[model samples]
Target chain A: MGKPTGFLEFHRELPANRTPSERVSDWEEIHVHVPTDTLKRQGARCMDCGTPYCHTGKLIGGMASGCPINNLIPDWNDLIFRGQWKEAAVRLHQTNNFPEFTGRVCPAPCEGSCTLGLNDDPVTIKSIECSIADHAFEEGWIVPDTPGTRTGKRVAVVGSGPAGLAAASQLNHAGHTVTVFERADRVGGLLMYGIPNMKLPKSMVERRVRLMANAGIRFVTGVEVGRDITAKSLLSDWDAVVLCCGAAQARDLAIEGRNLSGIHLAMEFLHANTKSLLDSSLADGAYISASGKSVVVIGGGDTGTDCVGTALRHRARNVTQLEILPKPPASRAPDNPWPQWPKVYKLDYGQEEAAALQGADPRAYSIQTKRFVGDESGQVREVHTIDIEWKKSPDGRMHIVELPGTERVFPAELVLLALGFVGPEKKGLVHELGLKLDERGNVVTDGEKMTSVAGVFAAGDMVRGQSLVVWAIHEGRKAARGVDRYLMYGQSYLP
Target chain B: MSDAIWTAGEVPHVLFVGDESGCRDELTAALGAGWAIQPANDGIHAMDLLKHPNRPASIVVVLDLSMPVLEGFGFEKARRADSELSHIPVVLVTSHAADERVKKFGARAYVKRPIVVGDLAAVVRELGEG
Candidate 1:
């Protein structure tokens, strides 16, 4: 519920972004602060549609159509419109463990299904949510809620990504002694490494981790559970264990010249860049630099976009992104209706920067990389490609048809493969714990998020495939409830 | 009653220039049955089609902005410099934001990609009729 006629009264407005030309030169966040008045107007755009789909958080057409964690969007919108900033933060934190993270990196599927978006632009829900969270922190409203009493139950959470952190925080709040184990030296896994600083600043992540620590949640970094201590010891030691180790097995492009030196996986590039940037402000000689080199990024998802953006910041001479599929339609097609995530073409932040600097969008669709050609010194010199057509066969399934005589080559000194991850690696933790895995190679769990082995639970990318931070948070909260009930005689108070 | 027979040169045609064949094929099918669609890989190939002596009675040229060789603006510049080709209307399609810079290219019409089929067809028809 919002101003009764807010939809008609105020148009949706978001904070302005720093110019692409300017942002590419620095690693600072791109968005500028929007005045309080402008944000309140944005909040007014939320409609009191009898059935709001923005909070449904369902999977429609195989993509998220709304807030995955079921954030009480309309309630917060009404609160913010009334200038109830403190109350808005309270409502936001009630559902979302970390609104700050989602605010920055989330694609805002909630806006996609917003009733106002049916005819006009949607409410600036993501920005409003982020602002409220940030305001709460600035006002000293957010602090460690150290539980009054501790339940002697000890819970060991493997990995320190969104999922692990959420589980550790919630379980700690429920009075369980929680210790999170992270392999990386830093506590925040993907937040610290997977995501670049330009998108979600590491400072914000460190601040949240500090708050979580203050809440009595113990974080152990540079110590991988299965590798350092062994999964057997973890199961025997802790009352309950939650495996939040993400699907880090990146899918590879196993073609010719795959072993070339210049070709690197997307995560290896992003992780090292962030690490070096934080360690010495990149003064240390580390990270895969794209400076003065022709960079070619393969794949066309958010990860690929991140690679493009990072390469630009490195001052790559030129960047080209290749996508195997055809570009999406400019508008939603018949099969993709509203309330379903709109599969339409968009110029993301990276592509926008690329277009601004290179004078054209860097992405080339309907093309497939045939091979990577190496030079005399065994460095990737060129990327061989050919045009492809997606045609429907007699079986009613689409297939790729390569066009002959359409061979082309893109000069490349640096190539980043952002093809995405396949599944959770089943080598160490899952293997040693004797936990069951699904066909997709993800750890299997029951409705309660309990794995095959008793006292062992899994969530996030470990159970689900690599997904958004919002979904990971949702899974983590659910698993906490499962762990709580198991320890509390079939009852849980950790919603 | 005499039946009217038509030759390839007599049929109305649209010179489709762009590297993405998917967009070209989708638009070809959407325009539905009146005109001939000539495919060109880039602005250079598009020029070859425009300069052909036996070219069809072409009414319009639809091209993608970010092409491999001779992009839409480059093609527009070359077309405007040539008197014979300058008369043909040009339409630009792009995935990026259509700003003042895109408008300044002097295209008769520009459509953002994930293109709206009906909207593009309507623009093409209006330009052809004029």
Candidate 2:
């Protein structure tokens, strides 16, 4: 919309990524900043279409199609086009409670649904959004928007992940006394530990936490809700409770030799790496280093990708990611269309870096690990794999049929199970509260975002199962509105 | 019209009814999100698009509240009154801050302009049942 013919004039381009070879030497962010003038030119390609699908948070073909929090994509695109940086920040913050996290880590589904993408390359909505948010931070336009009047109400948000932080932010804006309880030593759950520092520096997460603290949201870390203070006591102490506990029960690989010493859950490995990096800048030896070892990452998703990147950073001799599913087509399939989430092959930053160093993609698709072959010292030394073929069974259910005589073994001292999470852990908090769980083990909630228990609510990964940061923010905002409604009979100033 | 949306197997056909350039542009932009978008100046033109070969198995209507020939309320009424268009759901797009006509016309959702196009697309998804 900035320039009527800008789409024709300018091609869809982003900041040149730091060369894979140079970036792997350290844990700094991989992307280099593009000039402000270039971003403006990119914004000029907004096309002012009658309909913009980029912000549609709807699920198409069972996958996310647009920004889940429904960021006003076109508004910021226009604002950036006009170089009205501050106004763009205001519009961005209106929807996304945390754009910097999403800007860094999120796979940009909004761009896939871009109107221009149907004809040409989609507008660089994510980059533009990031530029606006980052610029806001640089200009010091982002300050504590603390509520003017106190509502004399108390709300406790459990687990200091994206969802809990978002809920706290909204409730604080609505003039409610909010306290976020985190079991971790630090405030951010996944943001601080689960995600590696290179992608999102912990300083960014800390900056937001400090801002929330200034905005009147109190954070109580190193305190598990059901353990330290029983769920019943918190129910009495706080007027309303929101469970933002993430789905962190990592799905374990039950293959033979799972008891091997070197095999670790993806979260455990990442958590140690980040904590050690923070403690002594990787000098404390608190983390499981993949240095000088052949590492085999089981499962080929974001978690697996992160493991590969982390192992490479630690100077692993070689890294291989085994994916159970067959490789996706290089292009979108007929069933997968525009505006819907495309199932195309993409070499993410991790895979890109691995390729640059190893001279090939680190992923080995349609492969399954049969067992972790260990050495005499009882440490994983190699992983045996077999090829798999998926076919429809007689009952019309698809089954993974093992292909014959494709057995192969790869040397490995470290084997990280980067398999995805199953659901929220149900032993402590869920058991103590007696919360109702859906068939898939997620907390069940009503239309009002209120859980089965009265005045108690659930949001984010706890309710939606494991999902993107954007959805967590969306749920957090909704749960806060529900809490506000419960506190003041239908008079919630929360959006 | 020969675009990615057309190449994709099948998608919901959205009939847009409005008199302003904003409405036309909105319809044109919606095309990028892989919908068979049919733009009409008013209710009558929209109905014509629905009758042609573009007659989609699943269709949703996006109507602007105010127009020259047929207003949103009239368009919805006419649509409901006719048997052929009764099953089709309508979503209202309005520029006015305080528009209550959408409620009267029974639009599934109303997206205010300085619009986020995603809102309209989301409502269409809900109504399209896709």
TM-score of each: 0.79, 0.79
What is candidate 2's lDDT per residue for A212-296, written digit by digit as tens?
A: 9999999999999889989998788887999999998999999899998999999999999999998889999999999999999
Stretches off by above 4 angstroms in model 1 are B1-130
Candidate closest to the true structure, highest DockQ: 2
Once model 2 is optimally superposed onto the true structure by TM-score, how far is the C-alpha of residue A287 displaced, in angstroms?
0.3
Worst lDDT window (10 residues) for model 1 chain A? Answer: A485-494
* Candidate 2: clashing residue pairs, number: 3
Shift in Å, residue B17, candidate 2? 50
What are the Cα lDDT values of the candidates?
0.88, 0.84
Kept native contacts, fraction for each prediction:
0.00, 0.00
Single out the weakest 10-residue window by summed lDDT for candidate 1 chain B.
B1-10
